[model samples]
Target: MQFRNELDFAQDLDQNDPLRVYREQFHFPKVGGKQVIYFTGNSLGLQPKISKDYVDEIMKDWRELAVEGHFYAEKPWWDYHERLAAPLAKVVGAKTSEVSVMNTLTVNLHLLMVSFYRPDNKRFKILCEEKAFPSDQYMLKSQLRHHGLDPEHALIEVRKREGEHFWRTQDVIDKILEAGDELALVLIGGVNYYNGQVFDMEAITKAGKSVGAAVGWDLAHAVGNISLSLHDWGADFAAWCSYKYMNSGPGNASGIFVHEDHLGKKDIQRFEGWWGTEKASRFMMKPEFEPISNADAWQISNPPVLALAPYLASLKLFEEVGMPALIEKRKKIVAYLEFILGEVAETVSGSFEVITPEERGCQLSVLLHGQGRPLFDYLMKNGVIVDWREPNVIRLAPAPFYCSYEDMYQFGQILKEGILKLSTVDSLG
Candidate 1:
């Protein structure tokens, strides 16, 4: 489809968009007393208006029912997190029994490692992408250290080609094979945060498993933003936070997926707690720790219904639109955004190079050569909300759910103005 930089063209696209109604569902931030064009859904999603109703229901239940709310309130607090299992499973392409909501992302990853990352003398090294999200790097390093292994020898990072912006799938597969008997685990962010590149998880998982290694994904940016088939991919485990594309409030609960093969295994090691015991026997005060028959076995505490409320509210939107429809709009809208960027670059004095590869989801990481923080400040002052990385890069994520084609066009205009104005100031000085 041919995309034009004209406002009418963008508006016409929005007019026919099936998901356009969703834009009204969110509350956007105001700058200079007007709504800013939001482009940071990769970092934090806009809050859903209905999220308040979900939170208020929980609050009202507490006010009216008190302790009895655990079992008697509408949507009982005892099993409120269970309500999310089916819908959340559908979003990530896993069986309902394989998915559960629990602690934050890093916490869940640490817990999952207890079950999946068992290193021994023969196979002790872990393979991960170079410059992983800092939390993940710390988690992996600390876990290795706890096992009495040196990070320099136990961690194998698959570095990108010297001049490239993304990792090649074959390079990751080759590293897994090269590690061979020494490889104990393969964990990586499904979508790279810095470059916005979507790794080929299926191929990499297959390669990892073939090498006798446990495979998992940190889907912080991938979940709700890209299509995933964790169960079919044979991933041992996966975890993601809900605050990004999932649109739960800041630092909310996380979702986990564990393969069916490992669900009821008695030999599997985990950091068990009361909530992980069988539901019927939980109140019986039994002495033995009989694990739940599914992914909920990973839970270390009672589900936080208050934090899960907004997440369930957001999942309702995913259930209504479905991923296929969302992906369809995502492809067209992102293509249009790329076209607008190219058009703007041709007109502006500054060079804008998009580092995000074709295998991306919503984000486009732009390398703004000869531009700096002043240009970013100019965009923020003028009502364009985007993410600025260190040095000279801006990350723009046009989420298919709430972001519109007009927002893309408007961002292009704002970005062009910033580049030209900054260039002029530099020249005059």
Candidate 2:
């Protein structure tokens, strides 16, 4: 915990880390031959070396069994999707029956909205955070139009107070109360994608439910990075993509959560598909639709096993390390990064600010005064992989599973050099 300087601190932390061995399992990108400092896990996770083997197994089964792979193959393709439920449930902190792997993130969001966001004449407004992921915003708007409602009138975007970087817990509660009788559903990201704020899900859910509105979340940024208890938190539903921290390759299948309380409700509406029919009668090809009794009822088609294999591989890693331990490691790594940044900020000419520390996950948004794109491009060209948001902010995520304390320190050093070099040019001019 004590260090002479940043590099010393990083080396010391790396030497003592219990999860240090995990870094070897992932396929970190190389520049010439050396591994790049990969801080972009918030965007796309590093692939597991085992991910190829997992996919190859499925491919082999497909090639050998052809159409018969579903029932006869090892691990049986027909029930392959069900295999993911228990492990994924543990990852999201839900009961096994409450979770299921399914379509992409946006698709699952729309499907959940169909059943949960039942807007009526009086309670027709849907509440969400401002600046949610663009796909989420588009889905909400399209869903509103599908129901013959004007999005401008029906969508309520809860924004941060003036000049603020993130919303306080009370700010969200206040908006839900203000919406009151008009609020039909509250849907927000589990973590703000741009700023990395981890919203208070339990508080948000309680507030929405108090107003008799359904509550849901888009967990794309939060699921693998934080410990979530959607069942105990009383969240009505949630959805997440696996390609980021989950390490499930791009455009991989997403997962969904539905509280057990909503499962038996006969009146709840969903877009029916044959795969969602009662498992006992699914193969009967019956004309009548008897939906499955759990969250799987939301499924529209049989799962894509190839897309799921990588997730299965990653989830195994989660089970081995466990969420609680992973979160503890994340806190240490994040705090270390924060400390280094604070030190560098004091020595630098321009102001540097962290936008979402109070309510955030592994990622941090840093604002560089008067310089944004130039610094961002400089960092990327130097083999430090951070992402630039438009205008001013740069997002760096030191993920727990594969990112190291050494990685954070090195990236911090690179950032300081970038800032110092830019300052020198400014002074010369």
Candidate 3:
């Protein structure tokens, strides 16, 4: 497709976009009485207009049924989360039995590690990417500490080669082989939050398991953004926050995937809780814990209906549009965004380096070489919503669900103007 840096071209693309209708479903924040061109869906998704309706339904059930809402409400609080398992499974490419909605991302990761990250005298080290999301970094360190191990010794980070911006698949596989018998687990962000690179999960999982290590993914930036096949890839476990591309609101309920091999097993080591027990026998008051026959066995508490409401609502959108359609739009839209960025770079004196590789989802992390925070501030003030990282990188995630082609074109124009203006100011000074 020939790309053009014109309003008419962008509008023509948007007009023909099959997924364009989805943009109207979300409520965008207005700046200066105009809707902002949002590119931060990689950070926090815009709230779905239907999310309120779902929340209201749960609220009405609570108000009218009171305590009886647990079993008697329309979406019985006892199993409200079960409704999410099927759709969430489709989004992450797993069986319904392998997926469950539960606590937040890092919390679920800690719990999953209890079962997957068993260290021994021969195998005690864990492998992950260097400069992982800060929460993941802290979680890995604390987990190592809890097991009486020093992070400096037990944590193996697969770093980018010398001045590179991305991790090569072979580099990670080679690292896994080097760790060999010493590697206990391999946990990494499926889609890196910094460079927006999608790791080769299938190959990495194979490599980790070959070395007698467990494999899991932090899919915070991956889920609802890229294609996944956790079950087919033979991943032991995975977890993700839904507030990003999933649009489940801020810090909402997380979804987890425990492989079918791990499910229905009483011998597996996991923290026990009343909610994790069998549904029929939960209220029987029996002392013995009978784990659920699925991923719900990892759940430690009853469903948070209020939180799950938005999630379920969001899943409805996924079910309607499907991941295949979403991915189709994602590829085209991201390519268009890349094209626009290239066009802008050509027109501006400032150097723009897109560190995000071709194996990416919706995000394009731009390294602004001759720009800084003031340029970012200029963008924000101009009603272009994007995410800024340390040093001088801005993350622009044109989420296919809500971001339009015109938004990409407009962002290019705004970005070009900001760079030129900043360059002018520097010259004058």
Top-lDDT structure, candidate number? 3
Q: C-alpha displacement of 241 in model 3, angstroms?
A: 0.3
- Candidate lDDT scores, in order, read 0.93, 0.88, 0.94
Per-residue CA lDDT of model 1 for 1-429, tens digit only, reads 888999999999999999999999999999989998999999999999999999999999999999999999999999999999999898898999999999999999999999999999999999999999999999999999999999999999999999998899999999999999999999999999998999999999999999899999999999998899999999999999999999999999999999998998767999999899999999998988899999999997998999999999999999999998988998888899999999998897457789999999999998888767888899989998889987788898999999999999998898888888888989998
Local accuracy of candidate 2 as per-residue lDDT tens digits, 1-429: 654346776888888999999999999887667789988899999999889998998899899988888888887877788988998899898999999999999999999998998888898999999988899899999989998999999999988889988888898899999999999999999999899999989999999999999999999999889989999999999999999999999888999999999885557898889988888999999988887888888898988898989999998898899998889999888888888788778777455798865667799999877557888888888888898887799998999999888888888788889888977888898
- Backbone clashes in model 1, listed as residue pairs: none
Per-residue lDDT of candidate 3, residues 1-429 (tens digit):
999999999999999999999999999999999999999999999999999999999899989999999999888999999999999988898999999989999999999999999998889999999999999999999999999999999999999999889999999999999999999999999999988999999999999999999999999999999999999999999999999999999999999999999999999999989999999999997999999999999998998999999989989999999999999999999999999989988888457789998899999999988877898899999999989999889999999989999999998898899888888999998
Off by over 4 Å in 1: none
**Residue 32, model 1, lDDT:** 82
Task: State every prediction's TM-score relative to the real structure.
Answer: 0.99, 0.97, 0.99
- Those runs of model 3 whose alpha carbons end farther than 4 Å from true positions after fitting are none
Give the count of colliding residue pairs in each prediction.
0, 1, 0
